[model samples]
Target: MELWFTGTNAGMPIADRNVTSIVLRLAETRGEFWMFDCGEATQHRLLRTPLRITRLEKLFVTHLHGDHVFGIPGLLSSRSSLGATAPLQIYGPSGIRELIDSWMGITETHLGYPLSVCENTEGIVFEDGDYSVRCAKLDHRIECYGYRVEEKPRAGALLVDRLERAGIPPGPLYGQLKSGLDVELKDGRIIRSADVRGPAIPGRIVAVLGDTRPCAGAVRLSERADVLVHEATFGGNLADKAELYGHSTAEQAALTAREAGVSRLLLTHFSSRYGAEDIAELVQEARTLHPNTDAAVELTPYAIARARNES
Candidate 1:
């Protein structure tokens, strides 16, 4: 899986960054993506990237802030124009349905595809055969939430050579064996899949959090994640200001990452107050606390690889 930061700034648009938005490419799908936030002009940002608008399958809104949701109406309208017929699911805190309905109704925008909105309470908001999304309340001014996307473990590769050594010819029974099912041969000999199949391949976990102060919920959601995407809206020295504004600094994000034992930490949601000169310091500050921290650069894609199991 990969993560692309569509926008990274906090309040206003900066020279280099936009607002808060992230794009995650879904695994085992047809070039589809799960959008984390739809900040203003987010669809416009997608045009500059390789992510296709038609391939967007879902959108997860963290809060009801204008910077985090002002682009929803425009994006949905644009999607219809782009000929997206597949249903789209949107998950967020309460009032999300009203927000969309009010804008769409006022503007008379009718979506060609159906849209599904979830209340996004605490628990598993979405789950399928491949992945499950868990939500946790964050300490933001509004009812913001953090999401943990856990990719399900995939089955190990089938041991064709082992099957051949056992004199088992390839057929539908081979499919059963690959699925961890025991198969009985025509001669009445039973073959156990455990003896032939390799160990299961572990899946990767990614946690993307919304705007909030450093809180326990963020840490819990990001526990042992392959990648933890958190916000660093202020400098490390601005602890008091960060808390008052319901935001986090680079140092706080790094501490959360270290505590959660995440493999990598991606800091984002930069405030426009910090100029380009402050970029290096912001990243360095996090790195000093957690060696694996990196600031999210706009339109940059970071790859999350699966952890290898020992033999």
Candidate 2:
């Protein structure tokens, strides 16, 4: 999977950054993308990338801040014009449904595709055979949530050479072996799937959090994640200001990542007060606590690879 940061600035757009929008592009087999926040001019930023509007399958809103949701109406409307016929699902905190309804009602925007908006979200929000997403309350001025996406472990590849050595020709038996099922040959010989299969492929975990002060919920959602996308709305020296504003400093985010034992930390939602040099300093400050920390740059895609099994 890959996370494409369309807008990384907090509060408002700056000369270089837009706001707080991110696109989580799934694998090619999934053929879809999930969005986190749709800040102002998000679609505009998306246009500069190769991602298609039609493939946007879902949106997870963190909070109702203007900078976090002002672009939803326009993005949804544009999706219709761009020929998106597939249904779209949206999950967010309480009042999310009313907020979207008000926007659409006021604009008289009737989308061609069906839209599903889920509100008052908590715990497991989305789940299927392949993946599951969980949300937890965050310590923001307004009600906000952090999401943990856990991909299900995939079955290992079938060992064709091993099967050949066992005098088992490829066919339906190969399919059964790949599914971790024991297969009985026509000659009455049983083959155990485990003996011929490779190691189980571990799933990837990613935690994308909303704007909030560093809290236990953030740590819970981010535990051992492959990548934790947390807001660094202030520098290390502004810890008091970050607390006052219900935000997190880069140092706080790094500490959280280190505590959660995440492989990498992606710091975003930067305040406009920080310039290039200040942002670099924020990253350096974070690195003191968490060596694998990076400040998210707008429109940059960060790849999250699968974790290797300890065994």
Candidate 3:
């Protein structure tokens, strides 16, 4: 899996960073990608990357802020113009339905594909065989939220060498053994799958939070996550201003990651006031608490590798 940042600024777009929009690309999900927070000009930002509008399967809106949702209509309209026939799903807080309805109804925009809008999004918002997504209400100016995406654990690899050692030639029996079943060979020997399978591969956890201050909801969603994408809207020196604006400073975000026991911290949603040098300094401040912290750059794809330990 990888995270591609389309926009990384806090409230508004600057010359370098745009507002908040992120893409989650999973290798096991065919060519589909899930989007979070489509800010203004998000479609234009996607054009700069290799992500296809047709492959956008779902959108998770964090809040109703203009900086987080102004691009929804444009993105939906452009998807239709680009010939995307696949259905799309959107999940967000209570007023999201009215917001979308007003936009589509006022513009008279007709989409060729079916669009499902899910409002009052919380608890287990989405779940399938492969993954589950849970949302928690966060502390923001409005009713914002944070999402936790967890991948299901996969079966262990079949130990072909051990199977060969047991004189079991490769055949349909291999499939049964891989499925954790006991297979009887032609010689009447019972082969236990447990004896020939490696350890189970643990699933990955990714937490993506919207604009918020340090709160328990953020920690709950980010607890033990492989990657925690939190907003660092200001520098450590601006902690007071950050709290007043319902945003987190870089230092505060890092402390949250540490408290959550997350494996990695990705700080994004930076203020436009910070230049490149200032952003680097903010990252450094975060590193004092969480050594694995990094500033998420726009249009950059951050790969999430599997953890070495199963825990």
Candidate 4:
């Protein structure tokens, strides 16, 4: 899996950064992208990357803030214009459908493909054959939410050496064996797949948080995640200001990562006042507590690796 920062500024746009937005690209699946928060100028940010707008299958909005949702309409329109026919599902806090409907109605824009919106709170919001998404409420100025996406474990590779040792030559039967299907040989011998199959490999887990303060919900959603994408809108020195504004500082985010036992921490939604050097400082502060911490920049992509199992 990989994460691309479409926008990283908080509240407003900056010269080098836009408001909050992220795209989680699943490398195991082809043409699959999950977006978190669609800030203003999000489509423009995609212009700099190789991401296809039509591949955006799921959108998770953290809140109803303008900076987090102003670009949704334009992106939907652009997808239609580009001849995308796949349905788009959006999950967010309450009032999301109203906002989308109002925007489409006011602009008289009609979509060619289906658009579904779910306004929910604190539960499993989405599930498919390969993945599941759960939500939990967070402490913020608005009714914000954090999402936990868990990928289902996949079937393990076939033990080809074991099969070969048993006088089984690689052939079409190999495919069937790998899928756990019993294969009959020309000698009328039955080869059970379980004898040569390996153990299943566990899938990845990613947690994404919107604008919010350090809270229990965030910790729960991010617990034991392979990758935790949390907002760091302020530096360590501004803990009081971050708490006052219902946002988190670098140190606060790091603490959440440590407490939640997340393997990696990605920090974004930076305040406009900080520059590149300041962002480095923020990352360093988080790293002091949580070694696997980094700050995100607009248009930068981060690949999520599986965590090593603890002994």
Q: Which candidate should be chosen as best, given lDDT against the real structure?
A: 2
C-alpha lDDT (0 to 100) for residue 276 of candidate 4? 94
All candidates: TM-score = 0.96, 0.97, 0.96, 0.95
Q: Is candidate 1 or candidate 2 better by TM-score?
A: 2
- Pairs in clash, predicted candidate 2: none
lDDT per residue for candidate 2 within 172-234, as digits (tens), equals 989988988998888999999999988889899999999999899999999999999999999
TM-score, candidate number 2: 0.97
Write model 1 residue lDDT over 106-217, tens digit each, in one string: 9999999998888888999999988899999999999999999998887787889998998988899888988889988889999998888888888889999999998999
lDDT of each: 0.90, 0.93, 0.92, 0.90
Is 1 or 3 the stronger prediction by lDDT?
Answer: 3
Collision pairs in model 1 = none
Task: List the candidate 4 regions with Cα displacement exceeding 4 Å.
Answer: 184-190, 307-311
Q: Can you give the lDDT of residue 298 in candidate 2?
A: 82
lDDT of 3 by residue, 79-164 (tens): 99999999999999989999999999999999989999998456999999888999999999999989999988877899999988
lDDT of model 2 at position 80? 96
After superposition, candidate 2 runs with Cα above 4 Å error:
none
Candidate 2 lDDT score relative to the true structure: 0.93
